[model samples]
Target: MVGRSVTAVCLAAAVSGAAAWAGTQTQLPRAKALAFGGRPVAAQRHRQRQPSARPGVGVSMNVHEHHHDSGERYYGPASKPILDAVKSPADMKRLNLSELKQLANELRWETLEAVSKTGGHLGSSLGVIELTVALHYVYAAPEDRIVWDVSHQVYPHKILTGRRHRMHTLRQSGGISGFAKRSESEYDCFGAGHSSTSISAALGMSVGK
Candidate 1:
């Protein structure tokens, strides 16, 4: 009887340990999700299980690693036919929603290609790709005065506003200034390098206008 009882306890302990191990393995992805922004574990699991609508269409968020090693630059086209057609913000206004989406992808690729060679504030520029497209599409620059704070983020804006050709000369001594400059282009209404200055500049422009 004692032998039987001992064996049963051992079996129960083994089962419990196995269950715990399995649970830990399942929770690993959720743990990674929490590291991003403390999202709930269940939501993370649900996202993991969900499939992407279009496979192989996702653009990599990471900056190109080749820029670190290669001396040769990427001089090829930044995007497909959609982006190639966009010469100015007025051109963007003509695009439908689907075309605009395609243009955004192209703009992103172009921005990456330019920055990969010249080396500028790539992250901020990339983060605002969609916003830059949207703003240019909706509002008229040079006239509307779309003042940008931390103008490091304005690479995409520059690309949309007829500065794509000069992107290769970015941040050089005689090249384009990395930050917003009214003299550089009329699209850059306010020139600022610090943060929290856009609101004041916008207000000043509003009053001045």
Candidate 2:
């Protein structure tokens, strides 16, 4: 019963966030005008950069095209359906059930890929992709804290939040920590390196709230 109530709360929060995001998008024209003095930053940057006549300077290279012959196999549409659209939980809220399922698949694949490359908690992270997405979709994160027990399973959560771009930096020197740390992100409400403390930490946050 408690679990179901928590799920309900999360879903309500996700919907609210989605509605807010939609509204924000509608106001983008005005926001852009204010942000960039009526000219977009992208246009300004493009105009500012003139190609250098000097050899070996300002030379554009197509590094991604030839960096790996098998890059398409890893990053093609089949493996990254809903994942590419998701920049945060607000984006996840825009997805329907079918899209959410696709997102889960993409999350799992991305997690596997990152783990294979960086060597961290693969099995645990793979096992919780759907659960993490569902939770983030329902709850207002960084506000309604979702504490993980022995947070080796939190890679998917990190990716769903604002840290997907940083997945390649997992567990490296000066990179994201292997376990959840409050300092790492607002989404990481409670630090978890060991088991059996998540419930207590969540209770503490709940009571404090």
Candidate 3:
């Protein structure tokens, strides 16, 4: 399948990149380190400004926290999950192709688990699971500027970029945003809810540079 091939290529590339940067961690070519006046821009400004329901509490993907008459819902791993080791994109480089594939599976499960409760865009996010994993794993984010068309397609992106803990609170009052928000995370370079805006935004970011 085309999707399977793509994932394989991405994993292979990630392995190569990781090996290249093994001795001394070097920035990926596309990665532009977050720099403003030669200092790291505030990473969690949005969280600091607007706190979520359970700050610092990791979300459990295995089961539904809410009780329903139907039954308890279970999603990903019960213990020692691949996703548990991945708090950010950088954490993905160490995983082999098999592990990367497993991570993608877990990431998909996490996305479904979060969106099922919060009620946001799901199809688009699911569609790009492998792509998101590849992008984050292959390139450096916040600096690399991986813009998504119709920002709702970033749930998996959010999960990979240090927002997994707040995923359960998504789209709620005082919670993480449904669509991308620049203040929400450095990884979200451009924020747009509607379609066909990603090209323009990418152009502007490129031209500005």
Candidate 4:
């Protein structure tokens, strides 16, 4: 059973939908934004740049030399669902703790595969892999919102919250979005792109509530 009192502090419950990405695109209403104290709410969008070949795409988690101990992420494309990886927030809840840990590894592996093809954030995803799994396992999706910042780390969020099938379409035109999109799912509440907007967005949400 998941700890009731909780051991680690966390982000919110981010879930639902697929986003369509374009060149150096601004991603608002489709990523980031969430409540404090790890309360689950719908996410806001975060518009940001997604240039082709900026850096840190497709690199392996263990293969890279830079700060692997510091938790380097590998958001590269992986072999097509060769494994039965969790694809949604509910999916995560259905698994046992041991299973969840394995799922996290696969998510990272899949993230590596996906990001490599599209060439986006990798390190952040790697660092947050365990955290993402725990959140999904704890909260129900489409209700709770967990905002991300500099949100290229959205890879793991996408896979767990029901966008695994579209992994290959990441960061592509007329494909999937790189940032969180409200249109994509109710899990997204506010939009973001630049930094310093996440906490404020969450605060506004609390006031509105």
Candidate 5:
């Protein structure tokens, strides 16, 4: 009877120990899965939680990287057929008012994008986009010699007058001048940074002409 009771107690203890070992084996895999799987699962959940229709409007992710390309990434209106066709003021003359309007919008956006990347006078460049387009449309540039007063406003002018390709090089070392340079292009009849100097230069050009 004593031997049988000892045997029964040993059997129960062994069964409990085996059960506990089996439970530990099952729990380890679950714990590892939770540890490893949680990150990607959470990332996927976050992505799914985001609104598909307006993905960028309110999201506080890194946007500057997406907004403009770095260093000759080719984000501009010059790629458009209309803008591409406009190699010079002569090309601009061929476009109708409607096309010119479209060109102005494209040019404005392009200038804005370029300036945003290259870091220059954005407000001044944007302000004169219409004027630049209209002037090129109406007058014969290089011959008529459209003189920009504070030549920072000449970004659109530069684009219109066969310098669209080199726009990325604005104000860089050994690149195109930010202000007008007579040697740079004939369209730039006078180069002046100051407002007062532009008038005198324009007057000199008018008198010389």
Candidate 6:
């Protein structure tokens, strides 16, 4: 909390990027929610900051070394056609509600196996699976910019748009980034890491026009 003459700044970090994707970030005023103590109006927002370069790979665990099951049916580059077939919001939109559940399932298993090997932000990314799918289903990528705050949750986003096969190479010294990288993806609108800042950046883009 940052306390000034009249107001206080509170910082919150939600692990759900899926919720962020749902276009459900609206909220009531803080003044109305909190009990007021004599003070001034505080200007508060999440400021994007450079991420602390966390070193060290995940401690290798061989909990299931005895039996390895690699029998997985995966779509190859053929998925590119399916991805290309999905262009606009109307195209990606789910005609059936069941697809959200299916997307969630796919994201979970993929995330677990990937992060199990790579060991990044496992919990947050797993939690937001539904939200990510919903957003992709609703918004047209490369055109409707989606800025991810605290970019960890973006792994699944990367996977769905066509990075599924790269799970084994995640976070390597010279591999796919653990966060958004312009070189890695065109889907990433603005790369960021911090508690929050997406809305502000989007506002700037809006004002740029």
Best by TM-score: 3
What TM-score does candidate 6 reach?
0.57
TM-scores for all candidates: the values are 0.64, 0.63, 0.65, 0.60, 0.62, 0.57
Query: C-alpha displacement of 84 in model 4, angstroms?
Result: 3.0
Model 4 residue 147 lDDT score: 59
Task: Give stretches of model 2 more than 4 Å off.
Answer: 1-79
lDDT value, residue 202 of candidate 3: 71
Q: Tens digits of per-residue lDDT for model 4 on 80-161?
A: 3423555557755667755655566567677766776778766666656666666666667556666555466667877877
Q: What is the C-alpha RMSD of each candidate to the true structure, in Å?
A: 21.6, 17.6, 18.6, 16.2, 32.0, 17.7
Runs in model 4 deviating more than 4 A are 1-85
lDDT of 2: 0.65
Q: Give Cα-based local distance difference scores for all models.
A: 0.65, 0.65, 0.66, 0.53, 0.62, 0.55
Model 6 lDDT, residue 113, Cα: 63
- Between prediction 2 and prediction 6, which has the larger lDDT? 2
Would you give me the overall lDDT of model 1?
0.65
TM-score (C-alpha, index-matched) for candidate 1: 0.64
Q: Per model, state how many residue pairs clash.
A: 0, 3, 0, 44, 0, 2
Clashing residue pairs in candidate 1 (N, C-alpha, C atoms within 3 angstroms): none
Flag regions of model 6 displaced more than 4 Å. Answer: 1-95
Please report, as a residue range, the 10-residue window in candidate 3 with the lowest summed lDDT: 1-10
- In candidate 2, position 142 carries an lDDT of 63
Write the residue-wise lDDT of candidate 3 on 14-34 in tens digits. Answer: 345434433322221111122
